[model samples]
Target: MDHISREVDRTQELAGVMSKIEMNHRAFCFANVKDAKFPLVGGLYNSLERFGDALGHNGPEPFTHADFDGRIEAAKAEPIQPLTVDSGLTKENVITGDAINLHDLPVPTFFELDSGPFITGAIGVTRDPGSGELNIGIYRTLIIDRNHFVINASSMSDLRRIYSSWEATGETMPIAIALGVPPAMLIGGSCKLPPNMCEFGVAGALAGEPIQLVKCEDSDLLAPADAEIVIEGTVNFSNRVENLLGEFAGQYGPEDAPVTQVNTITHRNDAMFYSIVAGRHPEHNTLGNVAVYGVQRSIAASIREVAPEVIDLEVLLEPAMGTLAHVVVSIDKHSDAQPRDIIERIFAASGNIFPVSKITKRIIVVDDDIDVHDPVDVRWAVWNRAATETKFMVIPGIESWELERAAKAGQKSVRIGIDATMDLEDIDKLLRPIIPGIDEINLEDYLD
Candidate 1:
């Protein structure tokens, strides 16, 4: 990680530096944040290698199908431990009441059109009012003032449901936002886990140990004890504000959320305020890929249930598509109609973690020979192997992702399915060109 000593503004200047860092897929620290007490860190999870390194996997694949299943199993095996009140989170300072000012923390306004500076990296901690279950998730928080902000929780998020339950009680919900938590914790928090599963437990599974938690100063909710900064707050459903922040889909997402009142701010003596550069950046997209842990696997399982011949699946996080993911499935095709059957079943399958019909808009089915992970090969199969008349299928009026910009009224959108596999009659003719000993050849040895 490189450290830039030059003082930077909390406005677009900080975000500008972050953009430059992201362009090179590098991690950076703004050592001197103008008008703030601490430095700002960005691009920590900017690449798959970096993200994988954080989780102790030193290779290209950060999250694999096996890893996803392991994480699910680990969460079931290890439950969240009880909270420990004493930790390094408040080693030096704990500001309360008038002393708590969010502006002093170097929160960055990543885009010019943003509603205000947003805390993009913090994990929100809340408790289920009825079940007494704890939940942790990453939600963009728009800073309203020195002591207030609005948390944007999506409709499908557990936090939103918890918010609704709290609202029904006509009481303020105690919430805590933790910044600079462990990488595993951050990844786990981003996953859309089952209602009864604890995110801390999932994080522990990823870390191969229990995650230490500390009780919040003003709330019963627990946050990572090793967090760099913690903001304790309470929110009521009375006030709602509509805001905007650039999202991972490379577009500005509209947000309508409840305003939260900050009660206390705690941090270490020398703290680095972490911020994920909002919108279409490497870190934003890489971190957002944590959805593969929950949604992608669920979709794959649903597809397998309907099409047992399916061999591989890849739910691509195309940055420009927002939440409408593009899916690629490779199948062991015995008949030409199998591809269409697989595609239709996938689009209609009722997903577990998320609705497959709502999230997936485009699906492509290729033969077992095709590499589902390779975009070029998938495109080649789509163009070269698929027939014009019957290979393409479009079903109108399907459910759309809520954040989809192109969706019609009533949140409706069209579903497209492509049978990129070769026709059963032309399978021999459509076989890909392959060179003998291509994998065994060492061009570098001969050239040198």
Candidate 2:
């Protein structure tokens, strides 16, 4: 829920944050866990591997396995499983009498640097008190008092706009938050949907069926059919220092963001709470790569010429740096023309990636053959394929994910760019000399 935090009220969103303390990123379904050799702690860890199946480049079973088809597919594969009841958790629908309370749930403290333990993946559906137009944003909520939280939202976000309008009059905006909608709904909440597009509707489209939602308690807003939990609240932007917490970005964000007062909380009888590992993406946060993969087709189209060889893009969440920082590119540069230009273009092309990468020196670009999704593979390319003189280039500083001094002024850095292609001078000769026995082995069988 790094992309949006109100959705944090749900089970999966909570799972992303709680996974940190728990250190478990397994999927909701057993099949995903059953098939892969390695366990997945976060959602959509590697876009390249999953993208292969999504685009018909691979088989449909893997797509289903990776949940590329999303919530509807998940439901189809496993069917509707009901949540039970509990004082802390529940199975009650949003519209029911049980749909009340902004407390009683174990919301997570997602990051070390956060001002407080913040709820990572909650989808807040707030209505413009005056206009009454519904706006859905995935915003992070930091619990300050049982009644309030600090919402980290940008001026560009719908929540910010709607809440700001309320703050102009010293009034609070009404909000509804839901947890554990279909995975597609969470992705949609994080996605750059069209203006006035109901994320719930987009979620349904992604699922290949209309998402079943129930009316939220004490509000006109609606939540998912099988939501594990839901929260309702109001916020006054004028409230200061409400939640002066650290954030997923591994730095202290200004508590001046705004304050949210949660009045009521509700959930299914036996609701399942979720937690996400806050700080990273490759192996930590899901928001960056989720968005990267979420928008790859769009990004691919946007920078087609600038980054043509980029058959894929993956956001490697650096554990040291939180989400939004340290994005690695797997470029398929066919020409000698400045591939750095592609990196520069893509650095700007991505939506949330720009600001975090500003301080960083380089957007490391490895060849398509190198699995950008794998740190070991990318590291290997940096050693062998990278020529300090020929492979890397410098670019002026902009907002970057570089944890170092890249974003700071006078901190120009030569971004290392590797033209790791077969196009390189007889690079194939240098390839790991495959011995007969080792090369002949069926690695896929072993992988299975």
Candidate 3:
């Protein structure tokens, strides 16, 4: 419940207080922003429980029943509904031309080495040039001046490809940056869907309803109608140097991206600007798990194709391991060779969006008894059951993630695979000790 003051430069203060709140698993707000009319809110998605609740799954084991595969399939099969042009965005305030000043916003600089204040929570809305399919994604935007900023899209991102297409045609790409959008849209925008897929439809499927949209004041691009703030602009083809931003991997990521010219800024009367604390904090890491949902499903599908004995798969998004770097699989295998084969197949597996081989750094295979979701249980199985000679594997000279610290000159690195299941010959000797009727015992009754 910390209340930030309206100091001239509260960036450092906000970052310091945010760090404290994250460690304590609490949410806080900036009741007073220095130059902005709206307050800034953060830490809404700091924990898995909070994230699950935001997604409207309040039941026990929310993520287990999220059904990402079903939602993705539905999005692909269903046609996207037309965006509704609502007047909510301009009902209260609208700034255009020279009146559009980015300095009025409460964007924060989270780290000492950070280039400047960045907008980490806004979803960029654009469309594919050829197909006219809608595309939405979260891209880090660096505010340059009063009405200018650079939007950083990674080389592999769809926005980059779309920008290239627009550049080839010598046309300025129209884009809209929507802040404080629905949680479902945030999750949908983060997913790596096929080029033909519409993230708006995916968002609709996720929320069991279509998201309301508003046409941008300056461009034809549509943004979330209920968004707290929307910046309407067109992409400038000129490349801009974006030095660094503290990323979820607990490291600084630098990039060069195209600049954007803001034409219009619109918001609600009582708008509340949303910000995700940048860096390797809880909110940053937990919110990043949304991006792994699609990858996990793709990996599971690939593993099942080669090894039908696979029971469960868990892709760990823990900050230390980085996002989607570590994967644990539980399987009922018939032979010792299955684990190695599964590992190779997974590394070779082509994902629906991005290649699985490119993202996974470590793969661990365990027996059905092991809970792949529990890191402690997985480590215990690896320590006690893995054979020194046959259970470990290393594949060298593989292309690793660009942000991985250990990546080589060309981003090439080694991948590790571990078979943590019990040896087929010593199954009886490796049984875990259990207390009888432990699940039926109630600690509350005994306490009384």
**Number of clashes recorded per candidate:** 0, 73, 0
Clash total of candidate 3: 0
Q: 35-121, model 1: which lDDT tens digit per residue? A: 998889888988766766777876555656456446555655765553465765554578997888898888999898999999999
| Top candidate by TM-score | 1
Candidate 3 positional error at 443, Å: 10
Q: TM-scores, in order shown?
A: 0.90, 0.60, 0.87
Error of 2 at 132 (Å): 5.7
The candidate scoring highest on lDDT is 1
Task: Sort the candidates on TM-score, descending order.
Answer: 1, 3, 2
Q: Model 2: per-residue lDDT, tens digit, 316-373?
A: 3343543333446776555655465666676555443233234233356766667777
lDDT (CA) per prediction = 0.83, 0.51, 0.79
By descending lDDT, how would the candidates be arranged? 1, 3, 2
**Candidate 1 ranges beyond 4 A from true positions:** 57-76, 79-83, 320-322, 332-336, 433-448
* Candidate 3 residue-wise lDDT, 20-137, digit = tens: 8767877777877677767888877777777557657665555542554455456557735645866665346888878889888888888999988899989999988899888999
Clashing pairs in 1: none
Which of candidates 1 and 3 is the stronger one according to lDDT?
A: 1
